[model samples]
Target chain A: MLQKRIIVCLDVRDGKTTKGVKFKGNVDIGDPVLMAEEYYKQGVDELVFYDITASSEKRGIMIDIVKKVAEKIFIPFSVGGGIRTLSDMKQVILAGAEKVSVNSSAVKNPSIISEGAKHFGKQCIVVGMDVEMDFSKPSGYGIVINGGRTKVDLDALEWAKKIEKLGAGEIVLNSIDADGTKNGYEIKLTRMISESVGIPVVASGGAGTSMHLADVFNEGKADAALIASMVHIDGYTVGGIKEFLNKENIPVRI
Target chain B: MKIGILNYDAGNLKSVETALAHLGAKYFVSSDPYELAKSDKLIFPGVGEAQSSMKILKKRGLDIFLREYFKKGNPILGICLGCQIVLDSSEERNTKCVGLVPGNSKEFSHNMDLKIPHMGWNQVQSTNNHYIFKDIPNNSSFYFVHSYYPDPDNQNAVIALTDYGISFSSAFSVDNLVAVQFHPEKSGPHGLKLLDNFISKTQGV
Candidate 1:
């Protein structure tokens, strides 16, 4: 039995850790290196660093932060946000990110996924999808990009399948509506995407409690759960989630 | 003593280096035949297509060197693709392997319910108590991320088995050569312990 993974997401901006509610109302959290070390101590299975800064000046500085975090943390680290080209992906990978994720760039130029996969291997390319419920659409969920500010008008499930075909090793399915809500995971949306794709699906957003993690694993059938606020706010430790899942007979690293 | 890590231009070398450092073992990342032969032990770690990796090995003449080294009973450990390459051949690209183990690697087609790659932590059932898992607890979880696995025909070659879609060899040992499908570097404390065990065995501790 494969153990379920608990990943802590650190949204980095201007060389500092920050978090936003539903991709809005950004708030400063702390230093990325410090936050990453803390999460590593708390037994996080993996760490995700998403660079949210909107300035070109901060791009190089962000890679420096990734280098700092990767130097100390032994677990797998993934870096995303503003990764537009193969050079950008290579820089991050060279900076010590086990995987590099592309969102807007992969959507605009789908070949970037194939290119990155070719250069760094498919296992290192992660496709991030921000999805929202659209009542007019038959699939009900539409793809959102550009930090969840723009709608692509494509079905989220369809896009996930397409990216997998494009050679994305894994899919990080983030629910825009469920982001920062702390209610629970969007089971239907996650399940649809997970079932539609053959690769691994990581469910992100709305993980408020330990039960929420279990709910996503049980209902969504997600390979892993990505939590930012819950762990950031000290609502639950990664070890705590693993313990809870272990008690519930779910395989998780403790 | 510097442990030689086979640099075939693939896989997680840094994480493996970190794990070795945590175990307080000094190692060198090398592909040079002389450096590899001079090292105390060799670690062949990889994380990609077998055909591509074998191509690089052959291009560099590492294939002949590794085959000769294993025959001398020099300690060698292969992780994931590294482990698969020790077999007679792989279904991947229909390529021939080092043939150190009496088997061939094949893709898991028996179970569709279980996902391919078998990524994440899974427990291993030891076939026989070897020094490699001395301090590691039984039923301990180790990180694994691979699609195809080697099915060794010799029962003595298998030292551990892990249940995924089916019971498969997770670790195998035949004299000085040992290999595992899991990544001990990424598997937390248990992983560190496994590394410690390997180092202790290498040092004759």
Candidate 2:
């Protein structure tokens, strides 16, 4: 059976790992390399490093961190944020990251997704969608970009389908409404995107407890859950979460 | 001690190289058949489409080199697409592969509810006590990212099986050649352990 993955997402700013609430008020937590190694030791299924300060000025720094993290952690990890060009994608992959995710840039120049997928196999390309609830949109969720600050006219479900067709092997569907809230995952939104896309959908944001993780997997139909505060601040270990999910009869790597 | 990572313009070989470096093993990445042939062991790591990969491998004469190298009985480890191409053929684009092993690579059926690419960690049940699986627990999950799987013509060639809507060979050993449908390099600690076993244990089967 294919186990549902529990991925730890680290938001990196400058060189330190930071966590912000609803993409605001971020505070430095720890070194991403060390934290990544610790979580890798604790048996996190995968790790995602998002360069929160995703600007052209900070790309060199992110690449350096990515190289350091790659050397220490053997598990699969994805690097996102500020990845706008094919050259950026190549630099990250050469730095040893398995997958390179493009979010806002993907929305701006949708061709970047197809270009990245063509240059590197689709498996190497991940489309990180930051979606917010908007009943006016056809899917009732509108695409938000620029770190959830700007709302776009695109529909979430339609965009997901387009990216899949554009050769995005995986979709990291992060609900802006549920992000950093700890209220629980937006199951309705997640299920809609997960069911609509043939590719694997990783439910990101709003993971408060192990139950929430289980709920996202079961009710939300999420293939994987991207967690932050639960493990980063709430003192939940990856192994402990996996054990709880195991008890819940959800297939997890144990 | 020299580990040559065969690079036939397949995909990113950085992860494989980084993993080997972390293992403190001296290695080189090369597409040149002569350079790769000189290594004591060869690690064939690949990603991307089989048809295009075959084109590059043929252009560089890596296909012939790999077959000859396998015939020599030198220890070779194949990962993901590397594992698939070792088979006789692949249902992916109706492509033919290097016939070192006795099977064909078949695509996972979309008719089933599961995703086409069986991506993620899945348990691999060891069918044979092959040395490649030494110290690795039975039913331990390894990271996988692929649409097609190696389907050996001979059941005996299969040393491990995994189920994802169907039972398929996740790992197989035929004499000195060992291949896995999963990426052990990216599979965390146990994955590193498998790579260690492949590198340290000179003999296979």
Q: lDDT (CA) for every model shown?
A: 0.85, 0.92
- Candidate 2 lDDT over residue span B59-139, tens digit each: 999999999999898999999999999999999999989989989999998988887678999999998888888998889
DockQ of each: 0.54, 0.87
State in Å the error of residue A4, model 2. Answer: 0.5
True contacts kept of each: 0.41, 0.85
What is the fraction of true interface contacts found in candidate 2? Answer: 0.85
Q: Mark the 10 consecutive residues where model 1 chain A has the least summed lDDT.
A: A67-76
User: Residue B72 of model 1: what lDDT?
Assistant: 77
Off by over 4 Å in 1: B202-205
TM-score of every model? 0.95, 0.98
Candidate that would win on DockQ: 2
- In the range A60-138, model 2's lDDT, one tens digit per residue, is 8889999999899988999998888999999999999999999999999999999998999999999999999999998
